[model samples]
Target: MTINIVVGAAIIRDGRLLAAQRAEPAELAGGWEFPGGKVDSGESDEDALVRECHEELGVKVALGDRVGGDWPLSAGSVLRVWTAGLVEGEPRALEHLELRWLGRDELGTVGWLPGDLPVVEAIAAYLG
Candidate 1:
């Protein structure tokens, strides 16, 4: 079976990670997640990530090291994450209900979408 791929940006600055709150798709709404979206056909993962960042957050990012291996999501998709630093523009919650920068100690303060919780933990381990 062909797996669907979703790309996420773990945009970190000043020891905090950027998280976006879902605004639609009621079931997932209000839950926090890293900013990103699904990859389009023929798009490279990195290109999709950059495009998603621009479309969702109105910002440009310089990708750093990847976070971990493919993280399983519901259905037949996987989430791939990369560390990112802002190369241009500040992030705005264009496609999200809200945006937050959570410090390492504050990671658990918000309710994360199920698929994002593990990635959040992985981020915390390195933020130390």
Candidate 2:
């Protein structure tokens, strides 16, 4: 079985979390998710995450804590997430349909993609 590795960022600023809305894949479109992508072969997860942030959000991020253990996803892929702080530039939804900052109490206003929902719980606790 081929296991795919995916990484995500829980970017927070001023006690607000950044959420990106998906713009592709008919099944996942319109869903909210953290802005990161696949870990390319030969690239460290950290490097992929940083590169993804720059590409997806047009910003640079300094990764902090890991959100949790590897999160299981459909098929054999697993998602690894980390808490991130913006190092430079404002977030832009370059690869997403939209970007929104949700405060501690507003995390549930948008429908999060299922694979990303568990991480949200961890984040909500941190936010509180």
Candidate 3:
């Protein structure tokens, strides 16, 4: 089986966590997620995270550490998450419908994509 590795970033600034709403791929539209994308071959997770953040959110980020355990995605893929800090540029909704910063108490209030739940929980704990 072919396995694909995807990465996600839990970008936090000033006590708020950034969440993005999906805008494409009919099935995932309107759902919330941490901004990131697939890890290219020969790329480190940190490099992938930074590239994805720039591509999807138009921001530069510094990856801190892993946020949660691996999550299985469709098509034999696994999603890995990390905690990130904004290093340059403000995050913009480049590929998403919307972007919002949620406080720790409001983390669970949004409709997160199913695969992102574990990372979300881990982020909540990290913030507390």
Candidate 4:
């Protein structure tokens, strides 16, 4: 099976992390996630994170360090996460149901997608 690499962005500002609510793919609907998407062929993870944030959140983000190691996704795909800072424009829910900023104390309150849980933990640890 071919492996697809997906990138997720943990965009932080004012000591809060941006969380997006998924609105599609029925199964993932209403699940919270860091804004990002699949990396295209020949595209670097950083490039893909930037592109995905633009496409999904209507914002430009400056990427920071990688978060946790790769987490597995359905269909032979792996999900990788990175920390990011907003560089231009505010994040709008261009593709999601809603967007919320969660403080380190509130991170555990949202219903994160299963594939995102590990990344969430990593972010929580990084923020502490």
The digit string of per-residue lDDT tens for model 3 on 1-128 reads 87888999999898899999999899999999999999898999789989999999888898888866678778689999888999999999989999999999999889999888777877886674
List model 1 lDDT by residue over 51-74, tens digit each: 999999999999998999999898
Q: In candidate 1, where is summed lDDT lowest over 10 consecutive residues? A: 119-128
* Candidate 1 clashing pairs, residues 3+ apart or interchain: none
TM-score, predicted candidate 3 vs. hidden true structure:
0.94
Write candidate 4's Cα lDDT for 1-128 as tens digits: 68899999999998899999999999899999989998999999899999999999888899999986889878789999988999999999999999999999999899999889878888986664
Residue 8 lDDT in candidate 4: 94
Task: Tell me model 3's lDDT, rounded to 2 decimals.
Answer: 0.90
TM-scores of all models? Answer: 0.97, 0.97, 0.94, 0.95
Ranking by lDDT: 2, 1, 4, 3
- Local accuracy by lDDT, each model: 0.93, 0.94, 0.90, 0.91
Candidate 3 backbone clash number: 0
Q: Which segments of model 3 are wrong by more than 4 Å?
A: none
State the weakest 10-residue window (summed lDDT) of model 4.
Answer: 119-128
Output the worst ten-in-a-row residue range by lDDT, candidate 3.
119-128
